[model samples]
Target: MSSSEVHLRSTIGGVSVEGQLHTLSVWFILALRLMMGLAFLQAGLSKLLGGEFNAAGYLANQPASNGSPLADLFVAMSEMPLFMEFVNVAVPWGQLCIGLGLLVGCLTRLAAFWGAFMMVLFYFGNWDVAHGYINGDFAYMLVFLSVAAFGAGRILGLDATIEQYDVGGQPLVERYPWTRYLLG
Candidate 1:
């Protein structure tokens, strides 16, 4: 790390960059959020609408490799038909909510966090067990964290609107001080 890095001021699409990477990062966050959000939304909706959707089959079909580290998860989840059924219903809905939230910039941080959690679960249960080479999940996780870290919701998002919302004739923050944590 040297203090030699110098950012020459530049402009793109008529917007000033001020030699700061933050300007570029804003666009990247939006793109990444949409990518992750839409993927989850479509996947969730497909499962719910597809009459033949079943988690058991998917879980049970995991190829056994190196003692099958994911076998326990598959077995435990499959054994309980009732729980499986619950999961079948819950997972899709959760995905849909997370996708919509991230897509709309509503509760963006929470949505990103949940999306990261789901990615983590899939990474462990699927890629780790299969010894897969694809590392898209890692990329997705990083993007989610980045968006959350930068408070992206305030940029062209409902979070900005929600933050200024008035409750009982007072701004949300003034009415409920604790809402500062939840608004954006």
Candidate 2:
């Protein structure tokens, strides 16, 4: 009800007119982003370097291939040795991009989204055989999903700049509430 408060509430482009100092949540998000990014980067790099990487042999040995629906799909996909080689090379680069994006808080949501997708593939590929709740890959996917949902990048990332400037009063963004979640 004060003049100052009234002025503060006034806005130019249908955006909220308020500002607040950073809090602990911001730093926590940043840390989580960095760690998650690093994890992906490491996995990709390890696979590319051929440092004890053997997904083909491992997949062939999985019990899921014993007449399961997914077995055929997996076998067909894994049969292309060239495809596996491509993945082995591409995954490292994807990881590096994700790691840098997350660590720098640049395009954090996009990076997290891709990271989660990769984790999902890894989870399904291995968990089909484990057949239990004790899977590390599943947990990792959850972490990536969490990061994407929470929009960890905006806390201290380039995403903040985009949200504050580039996406002003966009109806497309309004319809997709999840974008707000990712933009933070």
Candidate 3:
């Protein structure tokens, strides 16, 4: 109830929720955004610079060995020459674009969405349920979701400036309200 705290209330799926956030929560949220940004940026940079990254071997072997339920689908995908070609290029480039978007906080929600998607694939590919259903990939997927939900891009990010840019004499988001889904 302090003046510095933020009171939040909302309802989703007929369920009501309420909470309060400490002023310092913003800094932690910012930290999560920056941490994921840096990690992904570095990963993408190394993958691209490392040269000729291929997913065929991983697709054919890793998922099966890890006992993923999607192992058959992964193997089928690897056997497709055209699909493999696309995967070889898409994985690295997608990572690079996603990383850059997040690092700069431009098209952040879009980037986070893709990041979470990639994590979903990874979670299945790396499939280790021996310790439980949760793993690093699953955790990273949640982190990406949290970042998007909290609109972390607005915290020291380009999305804030982009959203405020004048479009037809009105702020971009104000003019096109739908952009709220993509930006902060």
Query: In TM-score terms, which candidate is top?
Result: 3
- Which residue pairs in candidate 3 collide? none
lDDT string for model 3 (75-122, tens) is: 999999999999888888888887777778888888889889999999
**Considering only N, C-alpha and C atoms within 3 Å, which residue pairs clash in candidate 2?**
none
Q: Which digits, one per residue and each the tens of the lDDT, describe model 2 over residues 1-184? A: 4333222244678866654334545565667787898887776776667675545654555626443445656666667899877765556778888887887777777888888887776665665543665477777777777777667877767776666553456643455556665554
For every model shown, what is its TM-score relative to the native structure? 0.74, 0.64, 0.96
Clashes of each: 0, 0, 0
Ranking by TM-score: 3, 1, 2
Please list the Cα RMSD from the true structure of every candidate, rounded to 1 decimal place. 7.9, 8.6, 1.1
Model 1: how far residue 92 lies from native, Å: 1.3
Candidate 1 TM-score versus the reference: 0.74
The ten-residue window of minimal lDDT in model 2 covers: 1-10
lDDT of 3 at 156: 86
Residue by residue across 1-184, what tens digits does model 1's lDDT show? 2354335566778987655353556677678777777988997888778875677766666623324467677767877899888878767988898888877888888888787887776665565524455577767777777777666777777877887798999877688877655445
